[model samples]
Target chain A: AQTVTQSQPEMSVQEAETVTLSCTYDTSESDYYLFWYKQPPSRQMILVIRQEAYKQQNATENRFSVNFQKAAKSFSLKISDSQLGDAAMYFCAYRRGGGGSNYKLTFGKGTLLTVNP
Target chain B: DTAVSQTPKYLVTQMGNDKSIKCEQNLGHDTMYWYKQDSKKFLKIMFSYNNKELIINETVPNRFSPKSPDKAHLNLHINSLELGDSAVYFCASSQGDRVRGTQYFGPGTRLLVL
Candidate 1:
């Protein structure tokens, strides 16, 4: 079974500053996908960004980006110019490619990120 | 418009009761899923239905059943609910084309088993 590991239980960053959330996973397949989801106080799971293993260049979305190291099987999320509204429970997820993979995702334990004003 | 929606946003029922949570998607997505978030905030896929057909059934207990009436709706029914069943249930939809199709999530239904 694939497993995502988020070693940090909590993280804090100053407003307008930058913060990085660590995530690693174990998978036997070389081709797959990685994602970062943010669950704010509203409790809605929002997709922050996604990285494809085949792509060497990292994925960036506005102020959000990811450093995906396929060899190390590590995918980390970087939040630049962080805002108070960015505070939420961030989760790292993995999805197997091909054969539909049941359309299921294996999620990490989650890291609570707090942005201080 | 909300891409994904789930009904019975909050459910509070006693043990031994049977209840159902309804999920619908307006995104024209072919794949729908049911996920449970435990007290520790662990989210795991319980079931997945693609085009009204069961595609993935995880290690979830038999007391839980998922029924898809059509491509737009997937409902979760829990029989003989136990206190351990209390948690937030989220409904999600995706294209499932194996081309980096993203999964969109609903607001989620908070279920409380008393």
Candidate 2:
């Protein structure tokens, strides 16, 4: 079984600043997918960014980027130019590369991010 | 248009009561899934359906039942709900391709069992 861990229970970042949320996972699969999801107070989960294990280059989406280290089993999310809208509960998820049950996502407990103005 | 939707955004029921949460997807995806977010905010997969067929059934309790009447709708019926059953239930959909497709999730229904 694969388990994702978010060591930081809470994180705070000032507006227009940058912050990073740490994430680590335990999985034996060579090829997999890592994802960061944001859940606002509205309870809607939104995809922030995704990284493929095979890709050496980190994935960047707008102000959201990921530092994916396959060897260390670490996948951290970096929020740049953070805004008030970035305040939410961020989750790190892992998914196997293939179809069927392998596609099921294993999510981390979540890190509550607070953006201060 | 909403890609995925779930009814009763908030549900409050007494223990031992039976309740059903309905889910529908407007996207033409072939796979749908039900996920549970516990109090600690740990999200886990409970059930998954593909094209009206049951695919992945996690180690969920028998009190929880998932029914897919069609490819676009998957409803969850919980019988004799308990206090431990209180959690936010999310419905999601994705393409059934060999490659892992991105899943679109619903807003989620918060169930509170008293």
Task: List candidate 2 segments past 4 Å from native.
Answer: A99-101, B98-100
Model 1 chain A lDDT-worst window of ten: A96-105
Top DockQ: which candidate number?
1
* Model 1 regions lying over 4 Å from their true place: none
What do the candidate models score in CA lDDT, each in turn?
0.94, 0.93
Which DockQ-derived CAPRI band holds candidate 1? medium
lDDT of 1 at B89: 99
Clashes of each: 0, 0
All predictions: root-mean-square deviation over Cα? 0.8, 1.2
Evaluated at residue A52, the lDDT of candidate 1 is 85
lDDT tens digits, residues B3-109, model 2?
99999899999999999999999999898999999998999999999889888899999999999999899999999999999999999998877465678899999
Q: Write the per-residue lDDT of candidate 1 for residues B8-101, one digit (tens) a residue.
A: 8999999999999999999999999999999999999999998898999988999999999999999999999999999999999999888846
Q: How well is candidate 2 docked (DockQ)?
A: 0.66
Per-model TM-score versus the true fold? 0.98, 0.96
Q: List model 2 lDDT by residue over A1-117, tens digit each.
A: 999999999999999999999999999988788899999999999999888898999999999889888899999999999999999999999888864643778899999999999
